[model samples]
Target: MLWEALGAARDLGRVHDIAAVLIRYGFGDLVQRLGMARALERAGKVLHLRGQDDIARLEPAARVRRALEELGPTFVKLGQILATRADLFPPDWIAEFGKLQDAAPAVPFEAIRAQLAEDLGDLPENIFAELDTTPLAAASLAQVHRARLADGTPVALKVRRPGIRPVIEADLRLLARLAEIVEAEAPDLRRYRPREVVRQFAHSLRRELDFSAEGRNAERIAASFADQPEIVVPRIHWQWSGERLNVQDFIEGVPGRAVAALPEGFDRRLLARRGARAVLKMVLEDGFFHADPHQGNVFYLPDNRLAFIDFGMVGRLPEARRYEVAELLHGLVDRDGGLVTQVLLGWSDAAEADSESLRADIDRFVDEYHGVPLKQLDFGAMLGDVVGILREHGLALPPDLALMIKAFITLEGLGRQLDPDFDIAGEAAPYLREVILAHHAPDAIAKRGWRGLVSVADLLAGLPHDLARLLRIARRGSLKLEVDVPPLKAFGDQLDRAASRLTMGIVTAALIVGSSIALTVNRSDSVSLIGLLGFVGAMLGGLWVLVSVWRGGR
Candidate 1:
């Protein structure tokens, strides 16, 4: 791992300008804090340094922009995620991170050609009537070019940059190792386990590298929206695709935001509503959603349909979990503390939690915030608080759940950007209500009952064999029993021991009382032998009780 980090550091030397800018902005401090100072120092000399006061003098957003542009794509991507994670970074950092673009210097034409030929057989001319030499855009991982098939069908060809795969793999391994170290050393960061985050990152990056996966994702989404004419997904040229190269029908449309910025006659409001509806349908009805719904990934088709471009990041919610999510959202909207708590606990796998204490915490959260409207509530803040509480109580959300939350937030933000009046809750209400009702409706109930009856019948059909086995066991005068002894047995044993001691304590008190009474009644009598015996017995019993109690406590 150290060798890999050293290699990465050496690679950074090639981008000296970026390194210089990073140090000049105050991002160096973050690197130092993360224990990468040695790498930075080895990469290149710090040509400039920005002190805290200097950072204060500049706009936070400007400083961050400089730092991201200087740090390159990996950190830029990390910053973008941090921007969404209001629970992790400050608002200013989030804002700045959001502005970090994925733009990078284009690879040489020869390099592009070599990768294309390696991925897709011969040169562009062999497969296409014509291929543009100039790339339309260059990004961190790949660049896209305009091309046309022999049949004159226009398409966009995305080719991976030369030698990027190894770099990405190496960096990911380093990041995963670092995450393990952070998890081991820092309790607070354990909330967002670095290893898990790296795993997610690796999954995403791997999918991004394989054009086939993105193609399939696009196909699935396209099929889901086939009934909706307002949404369009581009066709993938599967015959020309490979792990490192993707060819798809080129979409010719203005970017979503650019379309929104048009004159009043454009009906931006309608566009926003349609887009929100499409995304919500994908999430609620289909249970699959595009994780990245930013404006860049969206385009406005000439026919007023929404064109979705990238499918690199997508999320799938299992049917059962989707139902749970629906219930959770409904509970939130209804401000039902008991229901929310029940759903949360059902979702959790914590076995050591004190149910009573958890219930109290839930009650407090709901009582404090349930009355607030969804629009008025700060979901980011609420989620942060909930996560903190869950962590304190030894509960953690599964990675998929966290990713789903991030996707929802991204989609919600995109919708709001398109239309300020957009309300995800309002848009989701009709669909969720129907789902909830169908789940509990009489017809559904009848279906469930019929299913249950069928299962019971099957069990009954097998009952004869079970009965024969039982009879055989009875005849043999032996039966095997399997039981999981209650885990509380240890506590119960301690309680039993305490009870025995208590009984001894009562006997001791009784003896002492008898001795006192005898002494008082027979004062000045001959020997008072019974009183002496009672007193001795009482003292011995009391001492025994005390010793037992002490031992039990230890």
Candidate 2:
């Protein structure tokens, strides 16, 4: 580990040099914040000093943006993620990070040729009828060169830069270690879990490095969107693709953002709607999304179809959670804060349940903001408030959920940029309504009921054995059995509590029915006493069951 750390440190020095270029280009603030403040200060001692005012005059956000650009692709990608995490970082940092693009200095043709040969086991000439020596586009991870197969099929050859993986791996290891150290030393840092963040970054970067993975992702996304002709995903050329290199059918279209510069034929409004709808469907309906939907990854094809590129990062939600998400969104749309709180609490772990506090917070949040429409609500602000409440109550969301939230916000922001009037809430209404209807459909209710009945039957079937064991233990000189008696006892306690709850429900229903009957019958006010007593009894019984169940859990 020490040797690895030292090697990583050396790699870190190289990264620092790259970062220094960014810092020199007016991104000193971002460079410093990327865990290089001390190094930057040291460099400053050797390279003359600039006062704080001078640094501020350079514009902190622009400085950070330049630094990310200087640092190369991996850091640029990191900056994109940082841009979305408005809750974690300041607004200025988020704004600055958003400007950081993944454009990188292109490797020389010789280096690209060497990498292609190493990956494909041949020179470009042998594998292709023609290969463009000039790159179509150069990015941090890989550069694309337009080429054609021997069969005369036009393709794009994406060749990874020579020896890029080692640099990325080394930097990731250093970052992971740094995270561990920070988590150990700073309690606040522990909340973010530096190691986990690095791990996620490593996973994302690793996928990007392996062109085969990107190809697979593209294929899967293509399959998901097959029914939607307006959306296009470039077909991967599996025959010539390898882990380090990717070959795909070359997409001939301008970027979606660049459509503004194109001829008047393109329908910008329709294009924007198509892009937003495609992304929304991926996130809400399909539950599998192309994580990066920036302008560069989106293209406007002929016939006004929207094409998506780059599948390095994707998000998926489990089917159950996806259903819950549908419900949560529906609740949001309906302005039912209680339902939203319930769904959120259900998604949380048992350890996080502080019923009193959670209920109070939900009540407050609902009272404060329930009537506001989705268009009027700032999703980020709402999320921040909820996160703040959860933090105060010592609750934390699972990492995947947090990532999903980040993805959702990113999608929203991207959609807004494309179409300022794009109403995500309105667009999602039909989809969410379908989900809710499915959830509450008669068939669904019957299915749930049948499942519940089966569970009850299973418990009843076990009751005989349980009772026999109890009797046998009572008959024996020593009470002994292989059963996990504690859980069984808890279950019995729960059953008793349930019985108490049922009795309360019955009594409450009777009271309501009797009161209505009395009102209709023109009975005197004194005649309502029986209903009141029944109501009180029901309340006491319900409270008793709650206390019993709570104690049993303890």
Candidate 3:
């Protein structure tokens, strides 16, 4: 019991920290809804952590954004990830979460020395000609420092903070547990499937934790763009980089955010087109893309090129998704509402809904884009409305597809920021056409058909053994089905007690009658064994009845 209490207190302590931040940011109602308030009660009563509920004054979505920010890095990463799921959240929530940043206090250089030495294989001075003791940028997962190679090649060294993994792992476990409880206790919250969301978040976060994988992503993307001089991928220093750190060629150029700061000869229109083209090739041609290419992750070279940084989080367009995306785009561009509805139904995880209604809603949506030239159409707005409709209908896109759409929106939004008339659809059309047509080629179709045939053949070959095993289990009387019946044991116990009482009462009454008969038949005898045994059995039966009654009462 003491150990149980200690465990409760520990959970409560962790939960109180989360609850206090949430309540302070105006999410107290949410906390109450999730039943976290009960857990926080003891903590809250001891100290008044509940201030004014921020939700009362600010918009709920805005308060949620602030709450996630104040909750720290994991939540911040969650909010950013949630920002990508336009199919699940409302527009205001997405906008607010998009504002979530990984900005964290810098780990002093001296504090990170051990990690640097371990990853770099020696002291920083020995490994580099010069290493800036100060960080160029500091984020939650890692910090970047400017450094120079022995041959004077400028590079950026990203060092992971010591002991960050355990903190993140603990938070993930807490989140998983909370998600389970919320799903179990709150029926209304089940639709959001908090458990599944946490699962997805865990997968993404784990990938982000590995710097070595991120380095490989960089190399793959760079190789994809090797022939395109206009596109730049900073070369990764594989020998010196590891899970603890990432070293890459340091890029010197104007930040993508500073569009107005481009030199006199720089062309904004050309830059926007080139940037869009580069991203399209990464998506449609290469099936890989920089998922979060906001202006902050981009750089504008003096030679009018676009340099992409930060490959930590990227999206892969599988051949299937790529094909479907092209169809989706084509459907929207041509006002083919039937095709649009088909694509949406394919991605829906919920029970099949009214197809006709879906078609009507999509037809109405597609009609809005009619007569607008493809070049003039706002893909971002169109996508937002489509996703909003999906959210309304309880449909969810796969994570990769959602991330792909968000990337497109970000790219288009960035392009328009640079030049109001820039059209991402126009820039992406040729590339999309090439890929879609290639997939439909006779050879591609034949290859896909043959793969399907092989899979079906394998399944058929395995069916016999599977059936034989099931038959063997059934014949041996070993086939058992376990079910989840919460009150089955209590019901069975009641039935057992009643049966035992009935049987005991019957036996007692029979023994009393039989003993009377034996006594009647053995009259005048010195001793009667039958009468004596009958009397003894009666007494035993009576005792059994009394004991059962007492046990039952107790």
Q: How far is candidate 2 from the true structure (C-alpha RMSD, Å)?
A: 24.0
Give the per-residue lDDT of model 1 (tens digit) for 1-554. 13344454544543444435556676665444444544454444554455567666788677876666665565566565555544345456666777888788888777778778877778777989988888999988789999999998999998888777766665566567668667655666665566776787787777876778998999999999888888989899888787788899998877866754654445555776788778767777788888778778888765566889889778777766777777877776676767766776775555666767877887788678856777665443455555556655766566556556666666666666666766777777877776677678898789889999999999999999999999999899898777644436546777898899989999999989988888888776543788898899999999999887774453
**Candidate 3: tens digits of C-alpha lDDT, residues 1-554:** 11222254545565667778876776665676555665554455433436574356888788788878777788889999899999889888888988888889999999999889988888999989999998988998889999999999999998888888876776787788777767665666566678888988898788888988889999999998889898999999999988888999999999977877788877888888988988888887888999889888999997788899999898888888888888888788888999999988887655656778888999999998779997799999999899888888877777778888998898888888778999888887787788779999999999999999999999999999999999999999999999855357547878998899899889889988887887887775643677778789989988988988875564
Stretches of model 3 off by over 4 angstroms after superposition:
1-13, 26-49, 53-55, 186-191, 481-554
Q: Where does the lowest 10-residue lDDT sum fall in candidate 1? A: 1-10
Candidate 3: worst-modelled 10 consecutive residues by lDDT: 1-10
Overlapping backbone residue pairs in candidate 3 total: 2
lDDT of each: 0.72, 0.70, 0.83
RMSD, each candidate, Å? 17.6, 24.0, 9.6
Model 2 residue 62 CA deviation in Å: 6.1
Decoy 1 TM-score against native: 0.66
Model 1, stretches more than 4 Å misplaced?
Answer: 1-69, 263-266, 338-397, 437-554
- Candidates, ranked, lDDT: 3, 1, 2
Ranking by TM-score: 3, 2, 1
Better of 1 and 3 by lDDT: 3
